[model samples]
Target chain A: MVAHATPKSNESKPIAALLVAAAVAIVGILIVVPLVSVFYEAFSRGVGGWWAALADDPDTRHAIWLSLTVAPVAVAINTVFGVAAAWLVARFRFPGRSLLISLFDVPFSVSPVVAGLALVLIFGRQGLLGPTLAWLDWKVIFSWPGLVLATTFVTLPLVVRELIPVMEAIGPEEEMAAVSLGASGWQVFTRVTLPNIRWALLHGIVLANARAMGEFGAVYVVSGHIAGATDTMPLRVEKLFQEYRQPASMAVASVLAGLALVTLVAKFVIERRLEAESRDLEAARGLENTRLEATRP
Target chain B: MSIHVRSISKSFGSFQALDDVSLDVAAGTLLALLGPSGSGKTTLLRIIAGLEFPDAGSIEEDGEDITERHARQREVGFVFQHYALFRHMSVFENVAFGLRVRKVPSAEVTTRVEELLRLVRLEGLGGRKPSQLSGGQRQRVALARALAIRPKILLLDEPFGALDAKVRVELRQWLRRLHDEIGMTSVFVTHDQEEAFELADEVVVMNHGKIEQQGTPDEVFDRPSTPFVMDFLGNVNVYHGRVENGRAFWHGIPIDYPAYPHAQSREARVYLRPHELEISPPGAVANRLGTSLAASIVRVTRSGPITRVACRPHGSEQELHVDVPTETARGLQITLEPGTHVAITPRNARVFIPGPEYSI
Candidate 1:
């Protein structure tokens, strides 16, 4: 009886199990093994070796600090830009709306190297606005500002893409209701619209922050790789690896991998919480409907 | 406060949503704007609420022009059809939102919110979020929130449209009772004729972005001013014919036309409610007093106390519906089974000159 208790779905159980095993093997070989190898190699020379490579080396410390500084600034600027762009695209219909939306997706499709090159063409020392900036004695390229500009350009679309669909689904009806109820324009937005899209906005910010922290290609092209000044963590890792300090290179690589892990965990927790909240809302709706039916005459 | 809307018109792109729409809401009365989809009922309601600006119109409240005022300054309570409760707010906070925005004292805000929660019959459910409320309860929360501001007039855009049929009826009765208790000037939009008839002191029937008829429920039902209103109001059998010398002729048969106003019109349309068309035995004596047409029963449907008989006129493909009491059908010894011969007599009918506007 137990053997014959297999349902229709059980017929494919062996194939499903085989496919899942294959997926797990691929991930172990491609991802888990490499991640473990990075940490193992970083600590191969013992903790003192890794600590001296990361903390004792002044250039390495400066590279870490520079990365930490650039990420938050890029994320902050892009967050504001993303929210405003999403609102404009989702809330109103105007000529060239489709063009504007397509332009928001440019950063997603374009190469980061190309994005950096475009920024250089506009803001480089010999570029279009170069003379004006030089006259003001404001240095952008080959500096921290250039690194931030490149990172922001590369990560700009993350929040806007996340928020546009959510805002469109929420619609203007709630905002209209608030306004009709004597709320000022700002009050309506803060009280009604923001709460509706807060989860999506937070998810976007998390992703944008991750991208801003991890972006290397555009920053490499813009930073000029000046040691102890403009060189970021990724550039430092490359430099250490080329100089035959394999352990030091792996140590820096391990830190970046750890940040990636933190981002993944945060994403997982946020997604789980969002799912639970929606499920709870659904359950509450069901309970209310049952109670309403029971109370009806 | 009374509201007077004068010559309101709104257009989007190439399509007109409202055309020369004018309406007046007396103080302490409920008016229903009843129309099919795309008939501008909701548009007019939004205009009155100041949620939308009319291309050409002025709105006056309490004898003061308020057309240019912002929605926040208009002091009109608007309830959206979807309830539009803030998803993240509790029912208590939703009802207290207007008061909070107005800087009401915390003590007074709590008291007022609690009072409104009691008024809307959600006294123990204040802590629950809107997502935790049923459709009817959410609508009540919306009403309570709107009333929190003590608006001069209340506007609801199909408030009961999202509920089940049973809930709709119950909410209709509850809304009527609430309006009676508070006596606020209220306007609601609905496409349900029965709801409009049963709930409102006045009914405005709209079609094609214009008001076709506006009157008391009985007046609109009994004496529709336009063919659109007549068709929209209830199921009616229409007969196409011509009027000449104060007589109407249809299908080679003379139809009685008493005091016909459109006697000179060559094209005429007569409307007869299903109930007004009486079915009798083929040779009944009552056929002598009215225009009787010979027909064979095509179908019969019995529901509750009424039996609807669908009959095909002799020598014609069109079918005319007649509603008779089951008791009367039995007393007359006339069975409404299919293929049974019967005579359909129009007990009362209204004639109108047929034109483009008459085409529903």
Candidate 2:
């Protein structure tokens, strides 16, 4: 006979209920409040006011274009350096390795203003290399290149950090096996190591690009906030706030929020792609196993 | 098809993994390098496969020195303990890897790969990946992949070590059959005495980075040249004793063997197999006059079709296990009861002087 069990009193439910209430309250205070406030401030004086600020504002348009354009270029440069650095750090053991790795994190630990100031000292007039650079008629401290240089410095660590752990987890045996099977070094890299590290590389690119777009202090010091040539979104946000163009600034902030949303969506897409690929691989393996089993008996 | 290894050695820091180890394998023979873990069996196999380079030695295949040859150029096949099958490829692709890498014609590759899959009894499972195969099937696929190139030397490092007991036995016999069918020069490394005895034409037993003894299976088992070989090859009973004028006295028991005329009179030990202990009737004149033990049966165990009894000698706690037929043990009715009289005579035993660190 099946036994009927008596239900215990609901003692654990109240603690869970209390945790749910507190969690809702925290989310409301931190996320909902600020988002609603930004909307309320941005759309004040009618929705037309925000629309006019976006469409008619030439400086705002320039800043948006500059930010969008430079971020990708900076990310592309950082990617090359990041991949080389990650591979070197992951695959080799050398003296001062820990120190070299520590240098990658300097941009994260040090202030962005310090990074900007350091670039200025090295590339500005009267700086150490500035005299030689001036003779060559090159502009670095107060140009678009200087802006990219500073932004790239601040965003360099993300991709390298993301790629290192993944690369290290993939041991050298697969590469050695490929080489032993008569594959050239390039063939080994393209066939074996690249496939293993593709997802990590994509994730790193997304993070580095996002950081490059939103870089503030370093770009502000280096860009001179030139309207057509150098002003990025974060700098534009500050410039509008200073010029009493609050609604326009909030509109641009909303654009940044939209970009962040796009990044989050891209991250979701990357994660979903990874899941789908692994699932397909597992299903293929399962199909093969079933075929083998069917033939066995 | 002939392999010549001369004065091969490797040292990692202070540890010498191999020290001037050398051997030869004639064409179309299976050589087994049998040793415990860390005795350089796998290292030697890797060196022959060109996966490893010896510090100061030369390796030759068919009278051509291949010491400086790359792994791919050496044309050697290797089956690892873990198979080392490419996880990303199907079984057909895996078996075809060596040939495809060498840029063979596609039609030839397909024909040769299918033949090997059939040879390893894995014909229709060609499209399946390594992860899809059972342990034994994966091992066979690895063997087929190694053999696809028709290598000069085929090397296996504990090929069946990672399988179930029944699978290991079945696959070992199958491997012997395949080796005979292929008639290729093959060397497989294994520490298992049964595998070495069953699969190899010549067995090389190694210890402490050196070859202890090497011979045919029967020669190594029946006539071990050293105490290490005797103890390692099978279970043995060692007794500290002295041999004087061809008569050895062990544990105050007289053991006379005229064949051991070269033994010194100083302190020595005699190695005797448990099966050599013949249980004659108590107080009966035996072929050899050893002291009779009024011992008590400790435990009894059934191994396969035979019964083994563990007993301790009277007035002493030294224990010995003897294997006997079930009928004999049942006839004797030996149990845990004390003061059970049993007489044992060792028919074939060896005498050796104990080295400084070998005996306790």
TM-score of 1: 0.92
Candidate 2 lDDT by residue in tens digits, B143-255:
98888888767889888777767888899899898888888999999888889999999999997778888899999998888888898877787776677777787545667
True contacts kept of 2: 0.13
Top-TM-score structure, candidate number: 1
Model 2 achieves a DockQ score of: 0.19
In order, candidate lDDTs are 0.86, 0.79
**Can you list the residue pairs that collide in candidate 1?**
none
Query: What is the TM-score of each candidate's chain B when compared with the real chain B?
Result: 0.95, 0.91
Q: What DockQ do the predictions score, one after another? A: 0.43, 0.19
lDDT of 1 by residue, B1-360 (tens): 999989999998888999998888899989999999899999999999998899998999988999999999988899997777887899999999888889999999999999999998999999998877778898899999999998879999988877777877988999999888887999999988998999999999998789998899999998898888889887998888888766676655566666564546687887889998888789853454447878899999999899998889888988898999888988887667999988877777777777765574
Which portions of model 1 show Cα errors greater than 4 Å?
A1-18, A277-297, B250-265, B285-290, B333-336
TM-score of the A chain in candidate 2?
0.83
